[model samples]
Target: MSGEWQHGLLGCFDNFTLCLISWLVPCYQFGKNAEAVGESCLICGLGFLVPVVDIFLAIHIRGKIRESKGIQGSLIGDLLYWCFCPLCSLVQEAQEVGGAPQAISMGRE
Candidate 1:
């Protein structure tokens, strides 16, 4: 039940609306992504306001997604993605989870 990410990290153009939304309201988008993984949307969303907390949250969520999907990745890679291309990572996770409640339900055991 595990595999690679359905959406590539740089394939932002594949979902233009998602990319735009993630860019415009990152906290909201991050919240959505976190919620998809059964995390607290409000807390994770607000974590963006903190300087380093955001990175930690991003890394943790990315790990969750990778574990759920059986995608191959590392902590350093996740950190780099959050540091260099956070919006992309957000969109990537959102896309990976399909941004729908059903998406996570189907992804879990």
Candidate 2:
């Protein structure tokens, strides 16, 4: 695995649907990202409803993702991303872990 994010923080528009979802329902996107890394989707999704806990959860899950995927990043960077551009960060994480690769089919034909 590459020691880098599959999608850039500002590359949310790379997948318009995911970007829109991340914008329209941030909690859901966050939950999905958390779930991808074995965290409780409902707990994380509901945690996003809170103010302070949301940032903490985001940072925690981002760290889990980075560790699982071998992506290079720091907690401070994760904090900055979640604090400044949460939607973009959510979209990036979703793209990195949620979707199947373009060359493969994850769904039944």
Candidate 3:
């Protein structure tokens, strides 16, 4: 694959990884599963693999992106979202700015 493709592909995976890590980073939340941190990692990590949930997750951690330093470490997942899921982003922006999403049906035109 091209470099851009690789960036996007790996980027999304990295993003998911970061989101999972951030969600589980509080440490206390994984108290019961501390014995199996590996498995806990996988579970929290897998949560970001889903569609919309993952995107919101990325947004959730976005604030930490700056505090954690450059992408990767704590911010990789957030940055990866920039590579993936543009439609959702646009709609979100529209809703936030426009207040509500007005459906524009082709049939109407």
Clashes of each: 0, 0, 1
Q: Which candidate comes out best when scored by lDDT?
A: 2
Error of 2 at 13 (Å): 1.1
Q: Put down candidate 3 lDDT per residue, 1-109, tens digits, no spaces.
A: 1212213322323344333432444232221122122224344335446666545544543323223323333345445543475333322222222213234687843
- Determine which window of 10 residues in candidate 2 has minimal summed lDDT: 98-107
What's the best-to-worst order under TM-score?
2, 1, 3
Query: Clashing pairs in model 2?
Result: none
C-alpha lDDT of all candidate models, in order: 0.86, 0.88, 0.34
Q: List the RMSD of every prediction in angstroms.
A: 6.3, 3.5, 15.6
| Per-residue lDDT of candidate 1, residues 3-109 (tens digit) | 67888889887878888888889999889888888999999999977899999999999999898888998999999998999888888899998873232355546
TM-score of 2: 0.88
What are the per-residue Cα lDDT tens digits for candidate 2 across 15-82?
88778888898888888888889999999999999999999999999999999999998999999998
Error of 2 at 21 (Å): 0.8
Candidate 3 lDDT at 38 equals 24
The local lDDT score (0 to 100) that residue 62 gets in candidate 3 is: 39
Clash pairs (backbone) in predicted model 1 = none
Candidate 3 local distance difference test against the native: 0.34
| Highest TM-score model number | 2
